[model samples]
Target: GAGVSQSPSNKVTEKGKDVELRCDPISGHTALYWYRQSLGQGLEFLIYFQGNSAPDKSGLPSDRFSAERTGGSVSTLTIQRTQQEDSAVYLCASSPQPGTGNYEQYFGPGTRLTVT
Candidate 1:
């Protein structure tokens, strides 16, 4: 019954570099979400995957950002060509609901990325 875990806790990279952040959600959780918290953007929903369905990538900032859910369990978010503007807290959450409820998320501590 692990809650949720994200790696690196913090990351620093040069502009134009790429990064991959990992998320491990609670066992048996059918819904997973990715969000970003930044100075300008309070909390932006990035992407979501639920059960055996196609992921909702509507909130992805750009084509450079993509995510994949493997085996309906683990998910990885990849950011290509990072930029200074991309520096922010990358958070992951999981729940039982796919497209309902404001309580459909349980957040991770987030990966703090700094680009320079």
Candidate 2:
């Protein structure tokens, strides 16, 4: 009955510091995806996972960004070194079939990260 959840609706950190954002998807959903939107920018895919399949992390901005989904449920996005350019809203979504096509995703409110 629980829906997707993300920690620290807002986060502020200094440049070069590391930050970790968390997401908890809904029960029974097999697919999870992470996306990001920069200031006044559109959404960009970060990583996605479905069941036991491999995750797609092609949209990670740089080597400093990484993520993992465990138990096919909880996911964490880690920023090795924060940057002003890294400041954005990190969003997570889940669906019945993430690796499959045509299903709409349910999104979390998102974690807003700010770097100075």
Candidate 3:
């Protein structure tokens, strides 16, 4: 029973460069979420994926940010033309059920992105 995991624990990239952050959710979990935490700020919802349905991209900040879940397992968040404001800790979480209501989500260590 593995928990959610994120890659490149720390990422240092130049502004305007593109970066791809990866996440592996717990096996058989029907719901997955992506969030970003900026300095001194609360967690910001970025996206959500559940089973075979279309993902919820409403939380994404802009067109520069996008994500995809493959086979309902691994997901990748791509930040194109990275900006200084995009620097933050990217967190991944998964739950056994769908919706953001009462289900408990297990979180990963998070990938820290630094734009320099």
Candidate 4:
């Protein structure tokens, strides 16, 4: 009965370092999503996974960002060679269904990453 959750509520790293952020979605949810929120900006869509379908990774800013969902439950977002522009709150969400219709998604508190 657990909801979507993210680890290391706050992360501090130097530029060029790599960081992996973790997310645990609710049990039985078929859809998972990753988003980023920059300072004073709205949530920016990232990667999305639905069941066994190919993930929609068009939202990833660059090759430095990648994510994976294993066994359709847990997900991890890896940011290679972290940059100051990467500093923001990383959010994870899950929904019972897929697509951009009217499904509702449960969101995690988000991991705040700071590149110093």
Native-referenced Cα lDDT, model 3? 0.95
The 10-residue segment of model 1 with minimum total lDDT is: 96-105
**Could you say which candidate leads in lDDT?**
4
Please give the CA lDDT of all the candidate structures: 0.89, 0.90, 0.95, 0.96
Question: What lDDT tens digits, residue by residue, belong to model 1 across residues 83-113?
Answer: 8999999999988754555565777889999
What are the clashing pairs of model 4?
Answer: none
Per-residue lDDT value at 7 in model 1 = 90
Q: Residue 38 in candidate 4 has what lDDT?
A: 100
Q: Spell out the clash pairs found in candidate 2.
A: none
- Candidate 4 C-alpha lDDT tens digits along 42-116: 999999999999999999999999999999899999999999999999999999865558599899999999999
Worst 10 residues of 2 by lDDT: 96-105
Which runs of model 2 end up more than 4 angstroms from their true locations?
A: 98-102
Candidate 3 local Cα displacement, residue 29, angstroms: 0.4
Q: Which digits, one per residue and each the tens of the lDDT, describe model 2 over residues 31-103?
A: 8999999989999999988889898888888999998888888999999978899999999998986445769
lDDT, candidate 4, at 74? 96
lDDT of 3 by residue, 2-115 (tens): 788899899999999999999999888889999999999999999999999999999999999999999989999999999999999999999986554758989999999999
